[model samples]
Target: MVSGSGVFVFDSSGKDYIDAVSALFCATLGFHNERLIEAATRQMRELPVYPTALNRTVPVVHALADALSAAAPIPDAHVLFATTGSEAIETLIKTTWYINKQRNPKRHKIITRRGSYHGSTIFATRLGGIESIINSFDLTGDDILYAAQPRWPRDALAGETEEDYAHRLALELAELIDHTGAENIAAFLCEPVSIAGGMYPAPKGYFEAIRNVLSMRDIPLYFDEIVTGFGRTGKMWGSQTVNQT
Candidate 1:
């Protein structure tokens, strides 16, 4: 449990424990921020609950969106609010399908790396492609395709450099797209730095190589910044850290 004053947690014995996970990595401002409290108080005094849908734009909502977009690297970044990361993933999946449908109706498949975790929701979990989760829930579906994860500890062969591993993975993606017919593929979605898929700092030339392969067939490279965004990797955006932008 987190106290509003930066005090973290208390055991049954009444001893405090420092928050290690830091509220699912979301509390960048830390616990018990007075600013947050003041904002909440002010908003509660005005309008406590408001739905963003149905063409409603509350002042706080607009301010928050503007702040988020200002921080976003894209020139005209769009913001969509959701209760959880799972919801965000769901939104992403829908947005991907929507964008692809607008561009090419045939493109419907989403290529994600094995062992990656977007969220626990059905669509995100299906995109995750973990064997244990897939076996337990039968999540492997036709719409989501899996690619080999660049797990250096398990994947690198004897005498292979990290660059070589990255190249091989990119090549594998290309081969899969070729076999699957690139025209039918919608996007290659991956975390800029593989986090729960094992916190792998991207190998050198990884993003560029993969981008090159995906770009050849007009496939979109959807960087899952849920983990690596907001200076977690010491940059404003992970794409900026990896020079993907």
Candidate 2:
């Protein structure tokens, strides 16, 4: 029903509208970009296709991997490329499971927030906290857990300051960890800015407090930046925007 150019989509009758959604938040550079077209054309001309698995990689893939790894927040962090956000999320979940299985097989549970939308994949859907999506699918699992979203406006108590709200949320997370048993948790996953969930940024100090709790318990923290990455938040990364590290 829609066709178009950068930031503007035209209907069949030629009525154009701004594509504010940006193709599910992936096309941050907009559509029909000549630079992207040229890049793709050049790459196709050089190497049309190559498998990335089993150490088979093209020059462009290596270059991109190097760039992303260099830009990663963690020191000496490696990069794993996936075709989609959902695949990347699945990779994260599997990676966490692998690590926890080595340490303590029972510590495979992942903690996410209510209203979060991870993906449509079976395991990913189970990890997502959106009720409607989960209800639509028979994603039965007990390894994923949900926590309250850090939405200050909706969840904050009367007259509570932002800092207090953040602390309260942190306490709630601590309590959840306690109830669930830190030993049973592999990682805590969330978005720096919850866009699809509710379009709300975490209150100041919210991530910091969460990080403190997770660190104390030695639980890894994973940031789903598929929607918030690449300057959507006016920063190179959402973690930077939210002062997560």
Candidate 3:
């Protein structure tokens, strides 16, 4: 049993330990933050909850959306809030399907990397590449594809430089796309830094190479920055940290 306060949590025996993982990487401001509490209280006192669907929304939701859109790297980017990261991943997956179904009906598959962990929902779990998580479910289908992870320190060839490794991985991704048929793929989803799979940051130029390939094919790239967003990777977003532009 444990109780939390600030950045520390006390165990059953009263031995306090610093929460190094930020409560599974969500509590960036730590526990018992008075400002956050005050904000929540203020919102509750005003309009605590509201639906955002069917053209219904509250001031706070619009404010959040405006802030997020302003901060996004992409011009004209919009925002959608989900209750959890899993739901967000689900939304991404569904959005990809929806867009492709309308624009390119055959482009319904998503390409992710080996060892990536997207979420726990059916489609999200299938999008993930961890065998343990994937095998637990009956999702032996082709809607999701897996490519090699760009972990240089571990996957690099003995004589390969980081640039060479990145190039090789990009080639591998291109090969996968070719084999799968670009018309059958919707997008390539990835984490700028593979934290949950392992702390495997992309090698220099890795993202650029992959982005080039995807761009030539006109396939969209989705960045799952749930863990690495909001300055977790020493930048506003891991995409920026990894030089993805």
lDDT of 1 by residue, 1-245 (tens): 32433637566666787776556777766687889889889989999998888887898899989999999888899999888877887898788789878878889999999989988887888888677987898765698889987887577889889899889989999999999999899888988888888887778888899999999889989888887787777898888899988
Each model's Cα RMSD: 1.8, 1.5, 1.5
Which pairs clash (backbone N, Cα, C closer than 3 Å) in model 3?
A: none
| TM-score for candidate 1 | 0.92
True lDDT of residue 197, candidate 1: 86
Note the Cα lDDT for every prediction shown.
0.84, 0.87, 0.87
Model 2, span 4-95: residue lDDT tens: 69898888899998988888888888888899999999998998998888868888999999998888777888898888888999998898
Models 1 onward score TM values of: 0.92, 0.94, 0.94
Over 4 Å off in model 2, which ranges?
A: none
Q: Residue 185, candidate 3: how far off, in angstroms?
A: 1.0
Q: Number of backbone collisions per candidate, in order?
A: 1, 0, 0
Residue-level lDDT for 151 in candidate 1: 80
What does the lDDT read for residue 109 in candidate 1? 91
Q: Rank the candidates by TM-score, best first.
A: 3, 2, 1
Query: In candidate 3, what are the lDDT values of residues 22-118, reduced to their tens digit?
Result: 8888887788788999999999999888899998899889999999998898899889999988899989888877877788899988899988988
